[model samples]
Target: MSRTTPAPWRREPGLVGRTVEAFLSPLQDAYLRDTPSAVARLAQLRRGAGKAPEEVPELYGLTGTEGLYAQGPFADEKTEQRATVAVHTAVTLYALHQQSQRSRRMHRTGYELGAAVRMLMPSGEIDEPLRRRFVRVGTATSEAIRADRLRELVLLLRRQEVPLDYAFLADQLAQVQVPQLAPRVRQQWGRGFHAWRPPKATDSDGGGSKGTDTSRDAG
Candidate 1:
């Protein structure tokens, strides 16, 4: 029998999968490392709580006592570890929120004529709800290639002292122009906005169009 080598996809894990594992590894290690102390602290807390010796069960069953231990010195060593995870999560969330704000700001600033037509007549999928939200937020425009507008928006956000990248804004504009290119570039954007597509206009007969224009305004 011949043995075949593993494929690249099978050999190497995905970036997102690796990132998730990396994020959880520390927590898992902390939990494993603290298990013994956690058990000891639970026993001590249970004894202090006046529970009968017979009433004490294994660590898994010592919920109330273990919970109390987790809030005390038993939690000290894990403090920095937990804080590191919390800060990472918070920063990630903030960055996402900031990107959303910048995208909305760019949409509000309007595009140049050519850019506006391309945006309105997108050849690829567009997220209707997001488009509607942009329109509602007074970001809808009729122009295209509004680099100056994007720069101004970035400047406004920078003035607020928010650390944002104008390159991100430029990339976002490029996304608006050719959304299909997004999936090839951003895995997260592709996954999150998978169902997003440009709104389709209907004929007077009330029947939907057959092509990509089949999408209608989410509003």
Candidate 2:
């Protein structure tokens, strides 16, 4: 049999590998200096996850500012740095995708991805109280999205089913920003307050007399 010719060598791998190396090379140095904690956390996540490194979007959001502060030797350093990190993290995650199937799946889900990124945060950066608050808010927000509560709230507000008095609803809405209050409450408040109408005249059929004070004065 005639000898098989060897496949021609491709330079793409080397070119791509060099580009990645050049991009991340500076991060390795800067990371070593300014935010050792961040570097350590990333390493720990990589090790603990036991898979290709995937950059957590939440962590990126949190650390991106700090990363910009540490940029070196490039005019578009911040953008370049972030892009490099994103690419590297993506490649790392891709490599581990098959091995860490569960994590890959979880990372694809927004709630689970957010939770996982939160887990990687340094404890010192966020005190216990703030951490708890963030967790509660994040959980509620996630659940609301999953259940379509926001849409439901908007619909209720449109239909005027909310029960709060105008002034009270206004005060509550101002304080809590409840944009989803039922339309009933909104309409009652809007009409009563804007038109200067006294509270809707109570039914006079002995159900309740208008202008009858219900409160007992404290001695």
Q: Considering every candidate listed, which one attains the maximal lDDT?
A: 1
TM-score result, candidate 2? 0.19
In angstroms, the error of model 2 at 179 is 48
Question: What lDDT score belongs to each candidate, Candidate 1 first?
Answer: 0.28, 0.28
State model 2's lDDT: 0.28
Task: Compose the digit string of candidate 2's lDDT tens values, residues 1-219.
Answer: 001111122112222233333333343334435456535544533321212113244334322223323434446654444333433342232222212221111111111112222222332243454344433322332222312222232222223211111112112222122335334333432333222211244533333221222221110
Span of 10 residues, lowest total lDDT, candidate 1: 1-10
Per-candidate TM vs. native? 0.19, 0.19
- Span of 10 residues, lowest total lDDT, candidate 2: 1-10
